[model samples]
Target chain A: MAADWIVFWVCAPISIGSAIAMLLQRNAVHAALFLIVNLFTVAVLYLVLGAPFLFAVQIIVYAGAIMVLFLFVIMLLGVDREERLVERLRGQRTAAILLGLGVVGEVVFAIRAGVGFSTRAPAGFGAANGGGNPQALGRLLFRAYFLPFEVTSILLMVAAVAAMVLARRRERPVASAERRAQEPIEPSEPSEPSEPREEEPVG
Target chain B: MLGQFLSHPPVELGPIGPELVLAGAGVLVLLGGALVRRRQPRALLLASLAGLTGAAVVSVSLWRWRGHATVLGGMVQADRFAVVARLILLGVAALALVLGHHYFERLGEERPEFYPLVLFTTLGMTLITAAADLILVFLALEILSLSLYVLTALSRRLAAVEGSMKYFLLGAFSSAFFLYGVAMAYGATGSTHLSTIARSLAGQTGNQALALAAVALLVIGFGFKVAAVPFHMWTPDVYQGAPTAVTAYMSAATKVAAFAAFLRVLMTSFQPLTWDWTPIVWGLAVATMIVGSVLAIAQTDIKRMLAYSSIAHAGFVLVGVSAATQEGIQSALFYLLAYAATILGAFGVVMLASGRGEEHTSLGSYAGLCRRSPLLAGLMSLFLLSMAGIPPTAGFIAKVNVFRAAVDAGHWGVALVGVLASVVAAFFYIRVMVLMYMQEPLEDVEPDPSIVPRLAVAVPALLTLLFGVFPGLVLGLLERASVLRW
Candidate 1:
């Protein structure tokens, strides 16, 4: 139990600090590396919480694959220019601080409440996890949650189609006159490396 | 062991027949696009229409289930609530597809994926309506949003790219909030099924603080999707930048899907916490109405103005939700259908009005639309009049239905605010009508005479008047569907 507290105390600050550093870093690559560090700490926390599958996923998928993609995008887009950090929108900083403080206050209230999950017998994680966590997960996924598992394939297919559309070359057989009239960025876009469009952070 | 896991809970196919039909059709369109590369777009359009009609028929057929609330191991629901919402989503998706088909076809481009993606989005919308579990709900949401992000970016124009990017980012953030709420909910109740959550809450065995936090986060997530105030910063830009067809589809269909899920989740899983959540929804409703209407009056772009107007309509639906009664649920259903038909038709006209790369969506461009194309001009006025809640149109009855429900639920104060907001919303809607009818032509650019898209849009315009004049046509069924239970 004390080891649990020690693990939480040690991992919590590092995770949070890396997250803050990730936010403050101007160099995109460094920011991504910082995010990896934060994810590693989260994995450590997950490990201590007795969820090895999640810890593995956290490290392999997020910290490994996603960070690689982030860095690849950063390099390709040439957004590594070290510029002075400045707020593009006025009051953005103050707004950020105020919002951050509000979030912190909410978390503080939640912590002060100190209300862990209800310890009802059927509700306890350990009860369902007895036949091993992965086995339980497998059973649940196949039996109770079959529909979502199948639907995820559709989501991936849509994303594939989207990628194909965005990566199309200018030499494709679009109407020449309309292409010339409609697209100002068509010529330069063939190289496919503009300032990185907003990339959503994957969970 | 694997066989035991697979066969333990037998899955029901009847409840999800509409979703299956939609999925099969979507995949078929993708294959058709890939295989038959010549003159395929038109054929693809026909196939997609058949898909929608078939799905709607499957959904209608599910009505024989007659009040079955739990199916698929309580992971999916079968009820008139889901059936009606499915029909509405399919209707909107069909309109959006035809409008998009002609919009791109007029540009002389072969966008084969557009039809399939719309079908896919419709599938998601229909699936979410029937999602009885939190996991299924989130999955269905992703299925819809991912395709929508692609559809919004289908044009690959800078503006379209920007809109899709913003939508993708903000939507991902909100989805994370929703997932957190789901986690909290599961932790509190040890169940992801809505009925089980309700039972847990009713039994008072759940952690109150955790449940309350979960409710707040879940509302925030749905609020973003519905474009309620404070979470609606993306609405105007996304709407203005997206192709008019995509905007029309998403604006109408998304509200129906998200609000259906929202009604199901909050009104079911969190039913025991009704008093605790209503005040929050009340606040959201008030803010969404006041801000959405007032800000709409200041927009110059037709799409942006409509964006704000849609935000205001979201507030009206939230009013029904805040009432927290069976009548409230029925009225919200009516309001969603009304808003869907009205907005879909209105944007179809906007599609016609903005011809040639959709460059003519500004208010200045619509100075004399009536003289140039009286059919379009008249249809626009009718749709806008419905939006403004004028009598003899769907919007008026829809508004009255919601307010009456709120009053019945002892939420007369919110109903009163809703009435005033309707008046303010009327101003901007009427402003557009006045511009179309009275003002002189600003630019003599010819609007598209494309009959297919026009014919597609006219169905909704017809529906708007039909439902308004005879509200009883659908109200009787909605009354029964409104009786939501475990």
Candidate 2:
């Protein structure tokens, strides 16, 4: 009850506030720090759910490992120097507008359908198809779905490491474009600085 | 079937030995890299190599296993076919590790995560070959792709990021298609397990239209992965943009794994739907081969050229698949093994010859490569020749095997088209050879003096020639493994 109360009162507003602040912060370092606070609140929320393993993992993996990576990436890429807000992905606005339109269209379809989801299974598909989501998922998730379950764990591990690799390279002694860009340029295929700042519009 | 599955052991550990070993190894590498005060990332690389070798050994030991063909509640196929595919994937991963190690060490970088990412990718690819359930197949695909997308961007070049973005977006779209197909399949057959689906298909139960829709969508998903044309808009850019090591590794491994799943899903679950899907494969094969070769000839970037060449190669493999015969599977296996070796070595040379920052990958830069470093040029020549399907090289025999399989299955038109495409491909391969020997060397470009990468490249180069000269070396084993037991 104490944990629940603290989560609702202390962590809730703080988490929401930090998330908003994280989005607004111009400085990458400050933004990253705000994210860490938000992550901590998420771990507390997980603790309140009685998922101790998930709570520990949320803190250690997200707040500890991933946040450190964010900071390192921010510091190493000198992104903090580019304090001016520049949309890294140029077409994001267009993408968002299109996505918004799709959502509106979905809402219209849902209205026409009377019910968004069918309570009764489609004809000839019933308990034969494992009637409900949770029932089927529970059957598959723990028991006979051994390969997929184990594979998912490995998939998560790979995804985490890959995220690190994609975002977390230090400024080189390593063979990177930043160092390559410093050297005399090649006539063709100039390796750019690879930072997510104002990119030229090309597919 | 459900009763039988339940009657067996709930979690059979014996059939999943390689996966268990791979999981342990992946964790070991991940944890070792994290905990140890790192010296050379070479130790991590060595650890990964040991893990891959152990997995391969376990797979080999399982060859011709006498017990049940399905294990883990029929979620995985415990067959020689899976064993062979797993072995090939494991071997290529080991080579890719060495190449990755050399690529980084030469650059004076110590990325402890690289080896783990590679190990995990291998784990995914091997799992894909054995996965007998649609859910497992999708999971394995995601695992390999997520790792690959990250690995592509690991070089952190602007081009690398761009390529990663294209790959990630398109890959997500494909994954959705695949998942939707799985849903459709469940609707049609009331199960996501391949064996149950097969039984449903054979019995002509469940909705036929829904089942057909599932097949088409699943094909589109696998087609994207294998870089089959019409769905292959990302190939050239991603190939040219990714770090050469990633391109080299995934160009070979991804095709093999995707095609393995493709063949298994089609032959196992949709065998009764044979008449429905072969024409689709026929169209894909024709379009992929023709477009892949024709577009490749117009490429200037070496990586992009190799990209299209790989696309053409996929068509050749699909020709085998289109045959819908056991011989076709055998030939496809042989084709994958040879292509893996040839592409790994070709890209290894590109990695070595890319000068200091690994930037000199253009075809023009490769001019006078022979004069500057004869060893790299020779290795490059051997690999290119193999890729061109030239005689006395592995590619020649692989092409012959697949084309012959197509012909035997009465796919004469596809077999003929494949031959024509191979001929067109040879022009570009020889064009590279001509550039290396006939043209003057670029003064600014300097190949790295990395001995280990050179050795790694040499190993595959030797194998390429050996397999070429004697097709029986690996083909003998493949012949035994092609008999799918599901």
Candidate 3:
């Protein structure tokens, strides 16, 4: 129990502090690194709560894979370019701060009142057993949650298709013509082909 | 070990046969788009229509074979309500695809992928109506919404991209709220299945705060989807920015699907908390109707006007839902069917009236459309009249049924508000009509010469009139259909 208290006291602050830092950081890369720290600390906190499977998933899926993806995006998009930070709406920041504070207050009150802190597990909760999280989860998922599982797979496929469709660049002869017109006068060099080659032949 | 688990219970696929067929069709269209050397847009369109028809057939068969049954371990319910909703979605999808085929071909954008996306979206909508569990609802909602976001931007115009981005961000935020609500509800009831939650929440007054919070969160989430007041900032912009066919589909099919799920969740799982949530929904209904009608009167763009009009229709539907009675559900279902047909027809005419580059959507562009093409102008007038809830039109019957249900359920104030709002909404619809028939042609633009879009407009117009004259046909069908049996 003392060790658990120690872990909570140490990891909770780290997680909360890193989350704030992540939000405050101006540099995208620095923000991403802070997010990784926050995720790692949350994983430790999950471990302290005896959710070993969730802890592992938090570290592996979020801290490892997702953070890497975020860093890659930041680098690919050029991390040094500062965002404009335009305030499109009047009093937006004030309203955001007020809402954020309200949320924090509600959360704090809930925690203090132990609204969701129950020692007893509800009936039919499959995750009550220690060290059997993954196996029990698999059993419940495949047995009772099979339909949602399959639907989730379809959702992922739809996401992939949507990304592909949105990211695809249209082959425009007009664009090529404009590019050719903008090119410097090079009489000695043969004018580039009228139509750009179909890069990947959109299927 | 696997065999032991498999022996738990045999999974049944009959309940979800429509979803399966639609998903399979979507996959086939996608693969054909990827593999075929010469992209045949016409063939793809035909295949998508056939798939939707097949799915409709399956849905009808399911409704006949087993009118109501919880299947796939209670993840979904194959009931009369879901089957009917699926049929409506399929019909809307087919019409929208037909409209899209001509719209894209006219614009010279050969996007074969459009058909597959439509199929996928229809699949999502079908699953949403059938979903009996909260998890399934969220998954299905994401599938439908993500495809719609992409479809909104599919035209590749700057406005299209901007609208889609705003839609995607706001939609994602709402989805997170919905998921959080699901978690809270699960925490409260220890189950995500609507039947189980209803059972657990029945007559239990202790610890009601969490449950009330869950209800509010869920309502907020669905309000965004249905474009209710305060959560409806995205509707007009997205509708105006998206392509006409897509806007039509989004306006019709999304409402049908979202309202189906919304009514299911509220009527089934949250039924016991009616006293708590009814007043809130009553306020929303009033606001949505008034805002949608009044603001629409100020819009010059035909699509933007239609967007606001759709918002008002959503309010009328919410009036029925807030009543929370059997008659209310039946009337809401009938209203959805009526609105879907009428809106699709209205937008189809709008698509046809536009020039080759889709530049003639403004109200000014519609001036003297009667002189341009009498058939197009006549069809537009029929649809607009239907929207305005004129006598002998489907919209009038729908509004009357819903308001009657509200009044019967003792929501006389809400019913009154709905009637007054409809009166206000009629003004804008009439304004469009006056523009078409009374004014001079604005630039002598020719109507689109596509027979397909004309057929699309004609079918819905005929159906709207048929339903208007014979509301009893749909009302009787709804009478026989069992809803929320779980």
Candidate 4:
């Protein structure tokens, strides 16, 4: 019990602090790094809660893969450039701060009131009931939750098709031919050097 | 140890046959589009129609075979209500496809993926109506919403992108709220299945506040989807900005599916708390009716006007929901069918009247439409009359049934508000007709050259008249099918 308290105290502050830092960071990459730190600390907190499988998943999925993807998007879009802090809507910042404070107040109230809340697990749930075991989790997922699991795959497939449809580049045939005829004088342009090189051999 | 828990549970596919058929067809159509060198809009449209027809047949057969049974380990329920909702969804999907074909071709942006996306959305709607678990409901909602977000921006115009962005942000926020509500409900009741949640919640008063909070969040989530008041800011913009066919589909099918799921969830898992939630819905219904009707009268864009009109209709449906009776549920179902047919035809006329590039959706452009094409003007008038709740129209019958349900439940105030809203709504509906018939043509615009869009409008117009004249045909069927047995 003493060690559990020690681990919780150590991890909780780091998690909360990193989350705040993530919001305060100006650079997208820095914010993403802070997010990774927060996610990692949360994974450690999950470990302290005796759910080793959940801890591992939190690290592998959220801290590792998802954060990496976030970083990649940040770099690919060059969003690391400092964004203008100009307020687009009047009193937007004030409204946001008020809402943020309300959320904080709600969280504090929930924590303070939680001492009286019941902690007893529901029927057929707990560590002894294989809640911490990946094998048991997998079995339950495949058996009872099979329909939703399959539907998720369909959802991902739909997302992929939608993304391709939205982002795929359309080839303008007549314009492309006109551009090719005029490309010789602009071969040294840095933005599209490879495009002209690829057409040179074909031409 | 592994072998002990590895036994496979018996899985039944009959209850979910409609969803399966749609998913399979969607994937197949997607692959076919990729493999084909040229855009095959005709073939893909035919394929989508076939899939919808097949799904409808399966849904009807399932209704006949089992009537009501919890299938897939209580993840989904196969009931008469779900079956009827699926049939209505399939009808809307078919009409949207027919209309979309000509609309896309006219815009010169006919893509094969469009039909498959429609199929996937229909699949999501079917699953939503049948979902027995909160998790399944969320997944199905995401699937439906993701497809719709993409479809909304398919036009690739500035307004389309803006609309899609707004919709996507608000939809994601609502989904978060919904998931949080599910978590709270699960925490309070220790289960996500509707029947199990209800059973566990019965006579339990310890976590009443938490449960009430969950109910409020869930209501807010669904309110966003159905365009209830205060959560309806995105509706007019999204509706006016999305392609006409998509707007038509989203207006009709999304409302039907979301309301079906909302009714099922509340009627099953939250039925015991009716006294607590009815007043909330009552407030929403009154606000939505007044706001929707009054704001609609101020719109110049035809699409925006219809968007507000749909919001008012949503209010009427919520009145039935607030009634919380078997008769109320039946009337809501009848109203959905009638509204879907009438609105699809109305939007089809809007799409046709707007010439190429969708440049003529303003109210003034509709002037002198009677002289340009009497057939088109006549069809538009029929739809507008139905929308205004005039005699011998489906909307009138739908309005009467829902208001009667509210009155039966002793909510006379709500019923009165609904009648007043309808009277105000009639002004806008009539304003459109006067613009079409009484005024002279602003420009000598040629009628749509395509026959498919004309047929699309004609079919739904005919159905509206048929249902209006013979309300019993749908009402009787709904009366038998509306009881959602868990």
TM agreement with the true structure for every prediction: 0.82, 0.79, 0.86, 0.86
Model 2: CA > 4 A from native: A1-139, A172-203, B1-8
lDDT of 2 at B83: 92
Interface RMSD of each: 1.7, 2.2, 2.5, 2.3
Model 3 local distance difference test score: 0.89
Model 1 lDDT per residue over B100-201, tens place: 988888876678889888999999999999898998899899889888888888786789889989999999999999999999999889898999999999
Q: On lDDT, who's better, 2 or 3?
A: 3
What lDDT does each candidate get?
0.88, 0.86, 0.89, 0.88
Candidate 1 segments whose C-alpha is farther than 4 A from its true place: A1-127, A130-133, A170-203, B1-6, B66-68
lDDT: which is higher, 1 or 3? 3
How do the residues B252-280 of candidate 4 rate in per-residue lDDT, one tens digit apiece? Answer: 99999999999998988988888999999
Per-residue lDDT of B139-258 in model 3, one digit per residue for the tens? Answer: 999999999999999898888999999999999999989998898898888789998888888858324778888899999999999999989999998998899999989999999999
- Scoring only the A-chain of each prediction against the true A-chain gives TM-scores of 0.70, 0.49, 0.75, 0.73
Q: Which candidate model has the greater DockQ, 1 or 2?
A: 2
Off by over 4 Å in 3: A1-52, A55-60, A78-127, A173-203, B65-68
Worst 10 residues of 3 chain A by lDDT: A122-131
Arrange candidates, best DockQ first. 3, 2, 4, 1
Please report how far candidate 1 places residue A147 from its true position, in Å.
1.8
Model 4, runs deviating above 4 Å: A1-49, A78-128, A169-203, B1-3
Q: TM-score of predicted model 2? A: 0.79
